[model samples]
Target: MNHPIGEQTVLITGAGRGLGAAIATAFAREGARVAINYRHSRNHAEALAASIGPQAAVYQADVSDAQAVQELVARVADELGPPTTLVHNALANFRFNGEARKHLDTLQWSDVAAQGEVAVGGLINALRALDEHFTTHQGGRVITVGTNLFHNPVVPYHDYTAAKAALMAMTRTAARELGPRGVTVNMVAGGLLRTTDASAATPEAVFDLIASQTPLGHVTTPEELADAVLFFASPWARAVTGQTLIVDGGLVCD
Candidate 1:
């Protein structure tokens, strides 16, 4: 029930850049073997794996694809001894541009469906793929990346927000079912990060506006949020499951 992070092999999705890379780095720093999964950021992922040393590896898989995830899980198991922690961070990584974001009228079910395929469906595929590994190993950990937009919809990231809402629900519900199976599921929610692939397109004024409103007086960095994710993977959080720990700069309280 208490797996020290140093002994865990963490598989992080969409880990080529941005917050996912930070999360991968944090786990590697803790001496955990890391499988950095990326859909498109191949170069970044490869560089990250090299920087993390031999304990880290690069994997290419679109989490929404069931077959790809299955192959991904199998490869990780063959290479890293069955992932003890699965970090479902393969987010839409939705851009934060207000003008480019989806509005109520402009948002379509396709947009929502696309996000859902990754947000919810990806988790399902990963869990299913990891089922045997967790069972044979006796237990495992599942840490999902979430956003704080559900509490405070500061911008109109309509479809993205909707998908995360459902993901959060699944996180808790999965915990209920998986807890009995010795699997712990939880979420780490962060607000608009200071710098990430997603936030790079955000206007400087918007960043400044958000920072001013935050209690921490600064935007949260990817590393900061990534560290919070490590908490859930570490032994300290063994008894905690189906919970959401918002790692923003206290921008929104849950």
Candidate 2:
């Protein structure tokens, strides 16, 4: 199957800001029609769509909600045609301050379940919503944003890491099931992104420390990681699926 990035319609959840916004921009730059999905941050998402010109549009939806996701897909199809590529980047609200995080002893199952609802559950919703589109289009691409914490839990963001681990497993399983349909599912994991909304709480010193450990000598930026997402959606990655490409400057190798 030939899935060219330039000819695709890409739907990105939580694209109002941060990494999701960057991913939206990257696809728009590649000539694909972009649907920026946001549960909140309408201003940010709308502003982003404006910046991306007519090729991009904003849609509001809580990806973790099944009905909302169904409506989101229908609205995107009515407004921007069916999205041939899905980027599951929506995350439940979270902060990066390790000091503020609940320790293992204090962490509750609800905390983990909250993250899972958005990470794993959101993916499930997006896939189900796009199933028909993929069937009609003959092929599709699914990219789930993940974290390097799964590989090296240096900071031990227990809930976030656990949810992402489950997402990765689901990604692989979906890839296997979707392969015959010409739909490829994969993951793009990054470490300590230079500065996204979620990482705003992280101290500058931590960035410096992580950079020092990375072979590239710098923490990865959201834009840099977003490029890897384009690669997965591009025809170049037609034969690749069920894989996780870590974009943490060689900090963790899988």
Candidate 3:
């Protein structure tokens, strides 16, 4: 049940920029054929595909939409072969400014639902589309992008954190169900990435404080976190599943 990284076809959702872009680069560097799935950021996605050479291509898809995901998988299969790895990195739109965020009192259920629709719903769509491919091949890998906020709750981003928490739960449940089919499901949770689009609005003081508290003495960069994701998809992780690997420089112990 060894899944070699170099030979895999990887589809990464929301890979046009930020942490998703970094993850796509990491996989391509390892010789994986990559499909960069983006809801917007078409220019950036195309540029990234070009930079990654022939093994990578840009695809536009709203991962939360079942029909769109079906079409996306078809396109990826036609262009890059049926994807053996799926990275759920698509994020719902939100700013990182804690002061500007809505607290529990003002945060509506729809706000949380929006994030859940992307986080949880996107994973469901991908799994359904890839089920046949995985079964035919007898193996596959599912890597989900999550935040460490659930463990540390440094800012208590209620909507975002809650949705990610649910995603983590779903990841484990999926692992249990898909394990017999040889599809391993796991999550990679990171702290506030150094400078992704989502974290750009975070004040410098906040970054400095997080860095000071981290055992590594610096905020984790998306590239660093992306490498951890690569490990999960590699052959070395064949026996691992239903787990969450926190990649925030030891900022939180889980």
Candidate 4:
């Protein structure tokens, strides 16, 4: 059976593990070559690339740095061909104590702005630098991992939520600007994931509460959210752009 995105190359940030790892694996399963991006988890990223076989490889760079990001994407293009698809899933946190909500004063505004700058800015650079290849190659796809927190602020982590809101806004406007050039942009926002290193600090009670609130009787898994990303990256979703797909197991109806 031929997968929808077969023979394509995908670049995913924060692919050392968790949702990023899931997204990379899903694309690999579809027979797309994958460039797994990581900051400090080089060993784990290499291991995953190996698991995905020869079509997968790892790239290391701190996406927050624009110069480094441009160099990173160029390296991927030289090695595996320009990525036809991109997934931005990297994040940096000041402090995430899931046991208790982070106090406003305790969290710095830069902590939040840094995320938007790194993740969203990095995406812009990748798209712009990779634009020529996409034009030459015909079309490209971009999917950004977002959070449901922006739509419903009930579980307020102001910094994280606010950054995602900004990311979403960027996605919509970028889609409009990039649409004419055969590039599409979209966002897949999920609720608290079931388990990931980033969420390791999350308290068990918080997890239980989220599970109880979801109509599906459980929180979404990283793989589940990855599936939504796959849709946007696949040819089946060629016309779908500037859209936000909420994959929270009905925890958030909006």
Candidate 5:
């Protein structure tokens, strides 16, 4: 098996379940010590850490809270050493209770703003915290998760799409600012995966449509998307920054 990215520690936000959990597990399987950050789902986080053994530990932090994030990083450093790779995947949990989907008019602007704010704002805080560490460590990686909707925009995922678009923009700007310091920032945008908690609320027809459009003739999976992230975090992508790798099974070909 290939070795882990480094002897480095990685902090993965929203690692309690779904794609986040998969990413955390992938990193652990590769031998990286992991700090699984979760807003809720403490039980799930604990279980995942257990499966990954002593190299993995769970930390609670609402990425949206600056103070909480600061403390979370501090605690992780105190335990596992300073994280050299940061994955921002935390988001407000989706409710898949078959609630009626809100229309553009019914969806409040505040709701949309909150989504972008939480994701983008949390990124800013993470970068700021990582900057100090990177200054001494010389380099690190910051990988953000985005969605293919920013390019397609036909799915009517208004809040989610808009938030991801903003994230890509922030990613580009951050890369420009951090690149000079040996830090790299990038985004891995994936199309709708078939089996993530977030996609559970999506109707079957929607999945069928996506599957039909993808050139690969099937929907992507959480682990498939995680592969693109692993690429960004690896040394192979050292020269890549401020870019978005769209892993949508060729659905949204640029």
Candidate 6:
């Protein structure tokens, strides 16, 4: 177990289901007090918190709303203590099925902007809300979830991939800006996960195909990717920042 992670409070955005839920579970398993942030998945969030026992609690906030995020921080601080580790995993409405995806010909800037609102814009909001707490505490961690499509362009998910790429840029930039305050900002980019809410619409054949092409001979799961995310928050990565760890079963060598 990492030194301080097991003793700190963690805030995981969009943790009602999917990849976010996996992250929350990972934190709790590490003995971190988990604050599960969800926008619309109340039932799922409550259920998850319950299953995690007393170490977890659920909060609702649209990460894109600055005011909401501020309020969220206050609530979590009151209930779970000010979060020393933040996982900005909130994603806009998206499905990972390539067949049902928008192609470059039919894609629109608005589609891309919507994702940016959540990916980049939401990150700004979360950071703004947590910056003071982070600097004051002097040892906070910011972990953003990203995608591996930037290198492979497997399905050409124009909007989703573009937004995540922008997120990676922001991740690095934030690392530089926040590093002096004794904080580390990093990203975990995972390939098409074997099963998550966002990837549920993907065709079975696509999963099978990806598995066959991977060096590990299997598709990555949300839990597997979540474990890599844990690494960035752990003491082992104390000297690391401004980087992306790709967890896709070696499908893309990035």
User: Cα lDDT for residue 39, model 3?
Assistant: 95
Candidate 1 stretches with Cα past 4 Å from truth are: none
- Residue-level lDDT of model 1, residues 4-79, one tens digit each, is 9999988998899999999999999989999999998999999999999999999999999999999999999999
lDDT of 4: 0.83
C-alpha RMSD (angstroms) for model 5: 2.4
Q: What tens-digit string does per-residue lDDT give for candidate 5 at 1-254? A: 11247576899989999999999988887778999999888999999999899999999988888888889998988899988899988876453222455568788988778887668988988887777778766888889999887788765667767787899999999999989888889999987877878778878887898788789988899898887888888888888999999998999976
> How does residue 169 of candidate 1 score in lDDT?
99
Question: lDDT tens string, model 6, 50-106?
Answer: 999998999999999999999999899899888899999999999987778998789
Which numbered prediction scores highest in lDDT against the true structure?
3
What would the C-alpha RMSD of candidate 4 be, to one decimal place? Answer: 2.2
Per-residue lDDT of model 3, residues 182-240, tens digit only: 98999999999989888999999999999999999999999999999999999999999
TM-score of each: 0.98, 0.99, 0.99, 0.94, 0.94, 0.98
Give the TM-score ranking, best first: 3, 2, 1, 6, 5, 4
lDDT of 3: 0.95
lDDT of each: 0.92, 0.94, 0.95, 0.83, 0.84, 0.91
Cα lDDT, model 2, residue 7 = 84
Q: Give the local distance difference test score of model 5.
A: 0.84
Candidate 3 deviant stretches above 4 angstroms: none
Worst window of 10 by summed lDDT in candidate 4 = 93-102
Model 3 compared with the native: what TM-score?
0.99
User: How far off is model 1, as Cα RMSD?
Assistant: 0.9
Off by over 4 Å in 6: 1-3
